[model samples]
Target: MGLPAMAIVLLMALLQTGTAAAETRAFSKARDAITEPSHAQYEYIVVGGGTAGCAIAATLSEHYKVLLLERGGTPYGNPSIERLEGWADLLRDDPTESSERSPIQAFRSADGVHNRRARVLGGGSAINAGFYNRASDAEVRAAGWKPKSVQEAYEWVEERIASPASLGPWQKALKNGLVQAGVTPDNGLTYEHIQGTKLGHSIFDAQGRRHTAADLLFSANDELLTVLTFASAQRIIFNVSDENKQPRATGVEYTDSRNATHFAYLQDGFQNEVILSAGALGSPQLLLLSGIGSCEHLAEFNITCHVDLSAVGAEMVDNPINAIVLVSPNPLETSLISVAGITHEGVVIEGASGGNWTWQWPGMGQLNIFPPLERSVEMISLVQTNLQNLSSNTKEQIDQSGFILSKVYDPISSGTLRLKSRDVSQNPYVKFNYYTHPRDVETCIRGVKYLHKLLQTPAFQGFRYTTVTPIIALLYPELSSSEGERTDGAYIPDLKNRTETANWCRDTVTTIWHFHGGCVLGKVVDKRYRVFGVRSLRVVDGSTFTKSPGTNPQATVMMLGRYVGVRMLKDRKIAEETVNSRN
Candidate 1:
């Protein structure tokens, strides 16, 4: 029974272990409100205060004047975003207490899958599950970034936010099950990409404090950095008036918190640039709005197409997860999200959680799992079928909970991203055509079966119990119904008709939000993270990924910022030194 509470969030430490206090000061300053300077020129402008944005702007600010514009406010005062128990709260929208100005934006994919995106500073890292793992070597190679700097980037990000999590009872059971199932040689706690079971790191420290990417700014030269929260980048302002007109990016048009329009220009040289770290959704959407996407789409908004690149928003992919919930007979208190293992196929399996809102009848032998919505009256119909023998008096305790999540680390099938409208305010059309490829669907199924076999091993005999009903059946009871027409769109788990399983996976699928590859590397942007056909512009967020990495992408996204930022900082310094020598 993989009872899943679907939410993705993260926090980072400092650039070095000894600098934790300095990192705290950096995060605190980012949390503190700063006045927007009246002057509008900067050597570099980073759009989006997200995981990558904070890192990029902070890193570059050390050597040059930089401006970071985040559409949402700082994450400091909000408990819903900063606490561990509030992890799930980051995903759920609060209509009564929230407004359109709220930081977390709820969106629906083209396939009708619903999820959340963070509009706040620190972006998804501050609001995610806090699982902080570095990307697999495969991801680093494919991203086509400089290879040596990969470790440097990882070390840079790890120092700021990484901490090994102590395993709880549920996580201990998970490790035992995996080791028993031959899925592991038991790789202990690490931020490295290992083949077997390992105790992963988290952004939360021993005292439960959250240090996000925003904390990394502490390493930057604050005198050269100006962070403007609640400021949204609307479009890249191109210099069309230049002779030979190669579409040089000169500045950015933006809307402040008050919705007032403003334009911030770059310093005079070509070295000055506008970096879009607005994330997968925001980056591509901004490109399309700024007249850089497919000619046909931009034509709809009557915008002049400067660059007719068809792949600006192509190859958007997400980790479509399969969840199962199991109930434990005893209080299995150890910790939350402490243990994880990798299958031979690179699939990731993780243990239970306490932050979710699941209901149970306990000894009465009944458990209730909630999908984001009831979805259909039929989704939970079969959930109670396996619990008929227990008594009604056993109180549901958070300590006794057991559940797990299994996700495909290397997903092959990807979707496309397009504009809903030219407006920066509207969410884009994201179609994750998940499980569209045979290999992708096959991997997900193997992951489920692998974990299922692992959990049944003797290692879990005392701490966990075999679930009574198949989770897929419980999630989509319509599959079990003979009235096939009523459940026409549901997926069936039988191997004979894998297409049915694919359909079910698509219909019931939810993202762990490791969304990648929009404005992909080698497609929309070059290996250097600069946009093709557009000068002085680059993308430094998850949107630049060529493919999804096999673990939580938060660490990778932050590393990318550091990797790119370090290069840019070094290059600009050399360029400036050469100019001074010539003078």
Candidate 2:
């Protein structure tokens, strides 16, 4: 006799549960989290298991034992972070989620623009739109890095994380539109940051699965590397010399999830070092907290000053972005940044289309992805009156909309980072005075004009839903003198009038999330990336960059970690050989 229907159903459910248990998920706790207290010694202690942190640790682990301390947990098995489709959702802040465990930490800048930083193992690379492009040869030489070594470093990172992106419908259209707008010499598909329209490399695979800097850890000698996630580095442990009175970083003091403190130390060798790869904001913040920043500032917070480096949190900069949102007539593919139009005047154009547009402010005319804070009243009011017209649109129409954005290649205007609170978990206050420099305003104007040219291209006409009101045209209408539509069907007022263009640039300025500086090359660190007044301490991250490399800095940042680690190994080998021969 056959089994009863209910019995068959129960058996099927049991079988399914068994199969689920047997299957392994990718990147699910690939690196185990450390919850217990650890007091250990290693040849190298790298703070911040971020992009550079992971790379350097892996490279160093080949010969020396390394400890990589990350304040946040692993990105493994996080659906929101591991999938490209979850880009915006990954950035959106949830009030219910605690900052102590959130993969992305959202913070409001003093400039009134809201931004976010990574709090995961892979750092920004885990949360960012996975566009990968190499730095120009000029940038490599300017940084005083050897060309061959830089190439090798980049290749090492690329082989593990980056691959050629297969352009989706939206990116394909963007490529055609860019070329039609005279961004000529289409480089087809490439990883190099050349001047032209090209499809850059992506850390996302063909299946849209993201690969972050944490994956670089696979290169590490598993036995020699110890990655401690949920381990917040409180401060650097330094030992001052009695003879010279100079401080040398000896180890790092951190707290586990349970708030129990632990100390991780370096080995006895003089050459063994403590490196800070703790990002642009993080490295400086750690220095200040560790009593290595400005003496006056430290005293204000009741902290003793050790190094008195005034430039520790100076020269903060962010590339200002201005975007135009368009309602598309046809359904568009959801994609992260995959195409770039590089111009001669130091402006870059990139775009993305189709995602959950449910995150929006009423009458704000801006996606919540680039939401302005309450203090941004001027910016809010600038477009508030104009966006009221779209209040009646259905939610579905807004979902079909896409954006084309532009940014200045290298902005000159900058600000400083200061401590908001002494707490290690608190975000340091930073302001990037966007468009403050006259040249930056002009560069933005040039970039915006190119965006206009791109919209007028025939290739984009099919995708545009002109009848549904353009948010950009409504927000920043051309001045009366040039208010009329041209033959290309775009309002030329904002594009033709310098004053109007400048206003648009200022009013709508948002971050491309490419902020750099705070701990600059010559000011805070020497050519070797060592903190000037300290011994056996080095900072090797975006914090040391004079200017951001290429269209994005992720590739270069990862390469830098490997590059420096290899150099350190070579130098140590030479020193050891010399000592042996003399003996």
Candidate 3:
């Protein structure tokens, strides 16, 4: 069976299940109740109604009163959100025109691909391509964490969501074609499996639904949890102790749809906790505005520093993914697959010195047939030296390198996130510093060459494939001649305009929108997900990821949110029980 047949079969199966899932009633009463502001004060305040925020709020409301603050208005049965196929179309439109819009606009990559980030009530999850990958055992072990730490929480989440490989005939054909190519399988289970192989189509729930965190959080019976849509937090109110003490976050001050400014504080007689789920961009900005960023930067803005942790906005990492889109001669489409489906065996030959080495590299060593140690050390030394040299300001040289490498490969550029201003309204300064590392350019170059090899395989030989990148054409017109050409088991001609190709690489290479490492774990925050130097405040979003997870981070974010929420709830129960014993 191929991809199209698999899709039809999957679609039919989903339609049946969807009928039952769709029949489940939404919270009509609560939806109506919160439309007006007369509702009672909530016990917990969850800022940013995004992936993690939604999950945290939903779980917390199960046992305690909760309030969810969303800057965007309610989706209110948006058809675009409920339907899976509708997402392909929705990605092409402006998010601002819809009920919600991401603060950062989706930018076109150098190769003319769009990179989108969601700023809606459900955050990126609502607008994302509904693909699911789980973290592999190696990934878990590499992070030096136990599965028990988050296993039960992940199991509970998986029960509600499913990833099934129900491919139709056409889909299966495509998968088989990929297999026929040198692409090999990866032996791990995780969302966004980036191990050398590509496998499995992303799975939707039985009801053909992409399970956003909002779906998990909102329940019909939870009247105590009040969801306030179209409400954005302007600032968090902190209680100053004496003249020289650290200010504590008590509550948040916000503005509602009516333009009315209102303050939500801890209840008169109860201890309240404020969790910032405002995402990597929003959370760091909120902290800076509330005076919790670097003391030097905050002082420049004439704000007193509450905490002077320099790591609050450092060591950012994101996967720089480049896509190779080909037009299949047959009407075939692509879907997510397991890593085992695509990783090539013996690709990393033993004793292969220089770049092919992987044995000593911790992240790459997990693969059984990786290169030997000496080669790995050589590659590491070369990469470090290249990075050190390129870190200096040499725009012309870097640009030249970016273009040359990008034409035939993928680049591994690194960047940083810095505070642009103290004002919460201002966006953070994101300097991608793309192509800053020489090794990144080398990696990208290697990746492109590898892609070319895959394209030459019998599976892709007859496809009406062309590089869709206009920049590639503009720079290397000779290469464009082969665009839309069928492979004839012969080497394609090199670009006639090498300088033009170099120029294109220098100018056109762009980012893959995997922003990470603002409030990194173990540095800015403790292992428990609580921000360092701040009492009773925690960050449970992408910012907590210590390093970029090397794939789409939606599943990891969801897992982290679930883990933190469950832990917090368990600890709270223990504390309450201890108090009861004393009483």
Candidate 4:
């Protein structure tokens, strides 16, 4: 049916929006590139002015000279990025060809699914839906962060960026619907990720203005901070220690927007370091380019081996999303993720409304769905044929639709990220084996079943149709082994059957853009986030996560930057005092 194609269309559209106008507003401490008479040495050189990068750089600059390099421009006047109403435009306006100046970079995974990453200074927070929630207690315990410090870090970020969400009419219905469906114990409004239906905070303010990690820089000591825009990091410069023979990251080689080369280095202090906060994809890709991955893999691209850390780009994971589209009887207002249903079964329920897209399905007819850019033409043709045969009345209802989707929360199935080319701008080959693990598939089935229960509730009864199989199960009716008869002589899946539900999950699985785990903690980096084989180098981004922290990762990623920055300051102070005592 066209529903599967339409669902994919909706998901992709939800993840992306249009490009922002290029407006450069000069920050007192920021520049387009390394200016002449640049500081020869920095106590910290942070590559990637993204969510974590911005936070960590701001924190470190409190007492140290910090250099933050962002591959894209500022978000100050970018309407598509700074205003929440511009969300659809920012994601829907896909570029015909890749450009280095775009705020959002699009890529296709080896799984043949389209995904996106942020190139702007604020990173994903500059482009995402602005959902904000703290990591669960279990996630904190697993990471072994002290509770008191973790709380302080979260509060610090919250005070600057996070705020209570403004629930619209549609969001209010979704909240009640989730509660009625037995998600249990409505916690009202809260930022903590607990097991229940709760209204979480958002990074978008009451006026629908987005506050990103870049805003955190306001707290930074401007005299000690220097942010460079349009600066792409090419590789790390390392020097082998004379005494220990261990490679220490000494500097970084990067190119400016004009293709001019520049290098930034660390100070002479033992604690001076270069940190990589380039997200999951960017971080690992940089490692491979710098020859920190498997020696054999690096040799294929003619890169000299540095650390031979085979785990640099291994075990990549992404949370798979399965959604059900609902055609509202009346036009609904547009909204992003707000109300949440965090279930005990490892499923997180969220919804949005008023998303509309129209496509000219090749050779079929004009349809109200736009497939992801990378979806094969052959598949599109097949979907078009099926959609053409649909009754005119059915097509009309689909044009006005919203979506209630569930994420796999913590997926177990993983894959790898390998270099497609040595160029840092080009996307690496990444394959997230979604639904490959039995448990992941089973968890998705549970989520769908839960969604089915919600649609059956009184709050959602207005959208339900008894004569046909539920709209939720319409995506992949043919894939299911068990069938339910529709009045129109169409066969739909009986989702009540476990086997059918499992098949539905596998057929329609897609990403929620929460991919992580390329450079995992304890494997590639130590618990302190420092690379195992190298000194004066560390990774402090989502790439260091083995599992995502909460319902969303943006808040946690920002918190981590602050948390690690504070820890680094404390470590340096202790070392200084110890030296002073000996003297």
Candidate 5:
């Protein structure tokens, strides 16, 4: 025998861990969970090695020494994170697992709604649905970004993390349903943001593995890039200033794997800076913790105010989705589908087919999308052969295979994030305040109606056995005025689309996880993404987004990171030596 089975398994685990923990692991330790002593300093200290954090650090590392601090482990050896079918694994909350080490952090909003976010190196990209798309012209221009620069950034990101997705059987059916429902001119397969239905790209590779924002690091000058996993950034460290000089941020205080504390400082010259890309919730949390948020709230926590910026953790937006799970008679292939419906008002009816439905949602049948069929005495009597061998679990799994996750893109409802306490490891309070706006309620209704129309089409009916998701039908009773049936030439009236059922919208509305706008572009920071009243400090994540980007934020968030990185490279204040890091 080539080694014992248990021995082989142990050896393989060690090798996998070794590969992921090579250099970065050395920066952290485990005894009492403390970071070991080190004299190493970087030109830039990027906090929260997440989606934008990775992109910014990687881009800047092309010429400068960069230290990327992440609180979670590397994504390398995680089977649940690497495999396409493991999407839900990244979003699942295991309360039994400690927040400090868990890949998914569970959170509840002030409104009392709960959600989960990625705590791993790749951030949301490591846990999201992996649907990729470029930001619209309106969205890019909102930040006063040059189209060419933004375009270049988008291309750079695509080259590293994006691949054309091949439509599986379910995806093909979704495409047919969308087109048959008059989604638009049919843009076909693309990553561009066009006002028509199309099959976009995914972060998943043709090999069926996930390619997250962390993968962008490979494109960086590795010699200058240092990724420290399990390195939780506690707060931004700043240098004080005299009367004539503005205060500048010089470094960051972080805790490593061993819970050992460490400080990473910016170099003395060349305008060395500290960037905070710690995600929508994370970045704002860091800012507030560093005494950069509302002064009144800071006082309540017995923390001294620094910036007193009221908008640091305010003005958030997310796309409220209306998920409809349709049950099909035939079993479908397990893959990410890319069919979508686009409108000029920035409303998108996009969804994914439920592939890998069983593993992704083990108890999803409990949703009662379809009531299980009770066995009849006649059917039991008719079954004359193979009754003992039939797997009832497999049959139940097959019955729940069909799914359609419909979404209403770019909602108008804005939310906020606040700190629960001064403790660094503690999660901040979140309030999505979803569907408070009249427009958002209408959009949700319209999305539900549009999905209903899609279901009515003959192409979808050819395979779809019945409608299992009844929320849409409940929100607007007119879709069911005719028993939710697709009648020939029966167009749902415009009045139905504008239903004013506010409470239903609130109860049914939820985020697709594309949160933006906390430390806004101009209000919170300059277009260059610096925090006001702070020097050498910047927030370069979705937290800087001022409004809806009119699409999935993953790609746009990366592009913004790249765009801001280029500007930092060209900063006039940073001395030439400090800025140029070709060495």
Candidate 6:
């Protein structure tokens, strides 16, 4: 071909590529219709486009005009998120990539645990591993949740999301290992069964697509639902005219990515409700910024206290988790599994009754273990026995596939969120206080030890496995070698004399990212999810969870959003009827 002709062809190809990219970009930008001033006002305002906000906006838009405000920009729609097999790739990104974009400013614990969350649209769901597990009936009851209410909601969510439960061959191998360790299959703790095992089914749709709230809700109304991306809510505007001091939220003031200020008004001056669906950290921070939290804290900022509710930022709870990575003799391809209730004799241990200690594993099949706490000890013994039983080839398979055992201990250490500065632009001061409770630390240690025993079994004899324990060495180097001796001495210190070394590891600790409980039900929000002493203001998100479920919270958050959306619609209808009757 002639040089001129070749140059022309290349130019045409470049234009085609740019056009295709623009079309894809336009598709994503189209969802941000709410940011437009003309589209600002709505019957309802749902803040934070994470798990619950997406569902709430989708449900409310079906019946009423809705405006959804998300602080982060549109997702990149990376191939990793789209492919079902590459789900782990989402978790493989650098911690900074996740942290810098997160709505909450995360910090490392004194002992080296990093608390991180997603700030982007679809919230954590966009970045999470998509492990969906329902709350156990006993746990719900303990939290003053009605069994019938939760069951109905769980069933609705399951059917809507088409909860993934089938264990493929890879998942089965992991399940086999867990069973050999004495974890029996329990369906009740699974997402579908509610009292099943801790093992959850992978969240995949009928077309084998990963099922996420973003996919479910965004697909519902591409044209109608206006999602405002990169718009951060600074504060909520309340109607000062209400004689009863019942706050009628007028609108919200927010800042877009371009640093432009914008205001979204409510419809008809109708005083529609404002739903704070921002996750635990974001919700409380927004409330405190709006002068609705503890009067003392707000007073310090010289902001007039709107509601002097002390519980607004108290009672923060998160399930502390520790992971164990083992090299299997067999090439165990990675497949997600939920081992709901691990039992030895008859009693289930993880979620036991008495405050947060209650035992409940929803969704997995119910197989009662003998003597609750003893089950943990027995599980350790059984895992050791099973490792001995596995063939050398099986160990090799697991090593190649990157077999990892994840253990989530019910955290007894309760933390609180306090406002460090009233500045909306600055992140709040959050104290996770993780591992503060000796029991929580012990449970985590036991879980790690349990995993180590499994790796030492004869089944894994020929496999080369390593235990990465930076935090243990940093905090208690003395316990390092002794613990290493028991596990074949795989401890190796990768960092040396760096101030941020512990912080980096803490930031990297594999977290479920299931932050919940600040502004929790009964403590901060009422049973109906309405903020105490405030009207026309409700919170709908994982933050409102009275207690964080033992497993993933995406399913629960979505269900709550739907539940609150339905309630809001019903309330509007009742008001309309009352006005008509009076007329």
Candidate 3 lDDT tens digits, 178-248: 45554444333344454444443343554455566566664413666777776767776677775475566
Total backbone collisions, model 6:
69
lDDT of each residue in 234-256, candidate 1, tens digit only = 89989877657579888888877
Badly placed stretches (over 4 Å) of model 6 are 1-30, 33-35, 84-111, 143-152, 163-170, 185-189, 192-199, 205-208, 218-224, 241-244, 269-271, 336-409, 422-425, 445-449, 456-510
What candidate 4 gets wrong by more than 4 Å, as runs, is 1-27, 34-39, 241-243, 356-374, 377-399, 463-493
lDDT score, candidate 5, position 356: 41
| Local accuracy of candidate 6 as per-residue lDDT tens digits, 128-231 | 55567766556666666556656666566666555555554444444444444545554433454242235564455534355556644644454456787777
TM-score of each: 0.84, 0.88, 0.72, 0.88, 0.82, 0.73
Arrange candidates, best TM-score first: 2, 4, 1, 5, 6, 3
What are the per-residue Cα lDDT tens digits for candidate 5 across 100-200? 77787765456544356678888888877778888778777777999999999999999999988768776777777777877777889877777878888
Select the stronger candidate by TM-score from 4 and 5.
4
Tens digits of lDDT, candidate 4, 1-583: 2446554332233222233444434456567884623336799999999999999999999999999999988888787777766775555434233788888887778776557789898999998888999999999999999999999999999999898987776788889889999998899999899999999999988877888899899899999998999999999889965646778999888888888888899989899999999999999999889879999999999998988899989999999887666656665566788989999999999987664331122211112132233365455444434444554455544544566777999989999999999999888999988888999988987887787777767876554444444333443243233344221212223566778667666655666779998999999999899998888999999999988888999999999999999999999999989989999
Ranking by lDDT: 4, 2, 1, 5, 6, 3
CA RMSD of each candidate after superposition: 7.7, 9.6, 13.4, 4.9, 10.3, 13.4
lDDT for 526 (candidate 1): 86
**Cα shift from native, residue 530, model 2 (Å):** 1.0
CA displacement after TM-score superposition, residue 471 of candidate 1 (Å): 15
Off by over 4 Å in 1: 1-39, 94-101, 358-400, 463-504
> After aligning candidate 1 to the native by TM-score, how far in Å is the CA of 215 from where it should be?
0.9
Residue 372 C-alpha lDDT in model 6: 20
What global local distance difference test value does model 6 have?
0.54
Give the clashing residue pairs of candidate 5, or none.
33-258, 33-259, 33-260, 34-258, 34-259, 34-260, 35-260, 63-581, 270-578
Measure candidate 6: CA RMSD: 13.4
